[model samples]
Target: MKLISQPGPKTDFSMLLLFTIVVLTMPIWLAPIGAGYPDLVQKFAIYGLFATGFNILFGLTGYLSFGHAAFLGVGSYTAVWSFKLLGMNPVPAVLLAIVTSAIFALLIGYISLRRTGIYFSILTLAFAQMCYQLAYSVLTPITNGETGLRVLQSDPRILDGVITSQTEDGGPLITNFFGIDMTKTWETNIFGIDVQLNAGFYFCAFFLILGSYIAMRIFRSPFGMMLRGVKTNQNRMNYTGVNTRPYTLAAFVISGAYAGLAGALLCVTDPLAGAERMFWTASGEVVLMVILGGAGTLMGPMLGAGIIKYFENILSAFNKSTLEGMLGFLPENMLDGTISVLSLFVGEGWHLTLGLLFMVVVIFLPGGLVEGAKSILLKLTGGGSKKSASAQAAE
Candidate 1:
């Protein structure tokens, strides 16, 4: 297969700039939607990074892995341990998490990449489940079992002890960047709306931007072209005396590192690590995020992550009382009937709504939201004619 042409530096800069603006301004734009809260926005950044990393493997190389959550969990555990044994400086925790996760990914990818297709997917799922079980039961000493891992006052924080004073009241230490507490927020009134610009959210957003730039560079690199070739026809490349295994393995490792960074960010904000993060469901959720946002595209995964998180945080907050207030103008009987049906799709039933949305996207917009959006833009701008002209000329 021929190598894909790389995008120009100017194009890359413009795209990166636009992406940065969009992410940094999320609080301002999302305030009206009732999703401007710091915690939820932090989740948006963390999971967006997770899905973006997963896309490097699944999107580029067509490798469907079900064990990425294992790496994420590992990153979190490592970061928390860094806090317990080392210090609360997020820089070292993040760096150590990435390195440790990369190593884990290397070992896992080495074995898992031996198989292809369904077998590979099954192997990943099995490995992730094994990790979850170990963290939950077998590795109780390290993971703290179901109780999860957290920084404790009793733990020996050698680095913190050397540089900082002990807490006067002996409370658990909070994670921070150079003594800038992550949990602190700057709140203001924006056009009658309460907007909170959080330190932790900005911290995650910085990494998200960095990760996106790295992913973009990889996507436009020779290595990325090789990965796309592996996805298109591994056997053909093999026939040409090329070893595709290393390429796929490298992609897997890089993707794992991205996941690791995300997990570390999670701990940086919350300072806790749990086996639940390694569950198969978490892996599956990232897959959905990548697909829903449009795999193989730069902005798709982040968009998907935002949508899913919004639904999780906002839609799932609805209750019978909330619905009654929203529909109070209707007749009592009709309102009750409406609540009965709608209630089944919101709150605890939000998954049903997500599933329905997934089905609609898969059946009608196979390219996901990205494709749906492109189609709409093409129609509005009469861009279809330009695309047709190019195709006809090529033919």
Candidate 2:
């Protein structure tokens, strides 16, 4: 393994400017894509955080964890409990979730780091599975069993002066920061394009930007250099008197905290945390996102996350009628056959599409969509460097 790839010297503020532009204009771009709704938009930010954080460990240090979702679930449960017992304000909930998940990651990572390669992966998977089972059964009092944990009407929010489960609109109590309601949205129809922008999404986007900045700083730091050293050759680092375990453990904890933060954000957006969030498949999904987007690259995970969320929310909603409208130019029998074939990839069968895409990425674009795009651009310009291509491929 080549560890994290340094693509080249970056121009000052170029990345920052790009990230800012993308974050600021998502509502406009997503509107045309039929995913301008608040919930799906928030998901893009939350999962972007999760995948970016996972990349810090897996991409930089080559540690493939199959138990990161355990931290995400822990974060969710902690946030909900904070709301139920402390207050509806999300600041304390987010802080508590990060600290709690960090401690959990420290313990789990310490033990799991005793092994490397496949053994390490299995250890993380086992820990996550144990957490899932515990939450589902033994920890029912804490996790609320399979029904999951949610803010209840009768709970006391000690920090806030007034605590009511029902708002004036008679809807369920929503999360807020101070007096700014997280669920409040401004809906607009411009030229027949419906757009819904919510405060919750902006909140999540702020954190996502913060998280991306932190990840970028880490990637450029000397500490990040040490991590790549550990990934490339741990035994050689050990021989050179460098302690690799601490570095790996710290990365694991940081990644876990990131996962926890993502979970808390999920709760902040919807205020529901289910035991199912801790499943191994949830962890696998993050892994897929990292690999599919070009792991080790800053924007790759975010791109991968956006692709998955778009498919999950938008593509999966396409029914036969929607397909017919898109394929209206076809004859009746031909349209029906096309819809039947396409239906296997859209709607409830979106997972099949996801799987096929995953296979294509693995086979043809091993460095993922970003690297493939880079290769294409390099070819078009007739200035391709083999060394740069290899570095991009390694990522």
Candidate 3:
């Protein structure tokens, strides 16, 4: 038995520092791009965590599970239930959500791991769809069916015996850490830009940093190597007396725990749970995020999540009038034509733009955005490297 050493300290520190800086400064940098709003930023952190988790299983083990949304939904439901029965504090809610979702993932992974390839994918998708239907119909009592489950003042909240569940005018209770409200936002002007420092966004960002660090550790560990072996050739490993199922299952559970944490953050920012979170499309979207960014790479999933969410929230808000305003400098006839053609790629047609982008990435940069950036960098430095090598050889 041999020990697996940690990732090189310099590499881990630099990567973690860069990631932390990028995430923490998002509000300042993203303001010009119209994505600095608290709500949107919160979503970026949450989904980034989700995609990073999914990358663990799909990227390392080569086992794609489409039913991760079931774990997500379970986490959400568990968090809301915790708030309803326990207190308005997010700590208990988040802890319970991760535990419950991990257990759910364990059960699902145990069964799905029996097969491989597309059969495994289909099985996971089937399980997710079944969970969706159950939440939407049969499990209505717990999930609140189509209406969704939400925290209410009438709920027991035993942990907060004397704390008021309503505002001065009687509004619903809000989730908080200690006395700090999760929905609280401090608005300030920085360098002539409107910057919002949100409590909830920072909270989610904290978890995102933690999740990324843990994921990095896993990627550098011996267990991660075993999972990679499973991806490379499970049959060969099996023949060599290596039992790969346990490694694959562990990765699945860890990934599910990450999804659960993201789901809990969702409810922490907004105390509600819905069946829609468990939909097949939700699972599919995370898959797209991982693929669009770069599977098997740490920061790729987060980048993909940010791009997709930016399109969904900012680009999708563009209307005919909005387009006309931006293109007002053009001639009357030209402006109208431009708006007409561009209309299909913005606002309601944002998905069309996403599809085209996905197609281009798949065709040109099969390794996603990370690979594209790397290729560009190589081109920029390739000539200088060649010249230096020739000079050294002549000497």
Return the top candidate by TM-score: 1
Ranking of all predicted structures according to lDDT, beginning with the best and ending with the worst = 1, 3, 2
Candidate with the greatest lDDT versus the true structure: 1
Candidate 3 backbone collisions, by pair: none
| lDDT winner, 1 or 3 | 1
Model 1 lDDT per residue over 202-226, tens place: 9999999999999998998888988
Tally clashes: model 1.
0
The CA-based lDDT of model 3 is what?
Answer: 0.90
Superior by TM-score: candidate 1 or candidate 3: 1
Model 1 TM-score is 0.93
Number of backbone collisions per candidate: 0, 0, 0
lDDT of 3 by residue, 255-297 (tens): 9999998999999979999999999999999999999998888
The segments of candidate 3 whose C-alpha lies over 4 angstroms from its true place after superposition are 1-7, 161-169, 383-395
lDDT of 2 by residue, 75-162 (tens): 9999999989987888899999999999999999999999999999999999999999999999999999999998877777777666
Model 1, position 288: C-alpha lDDT score: 95
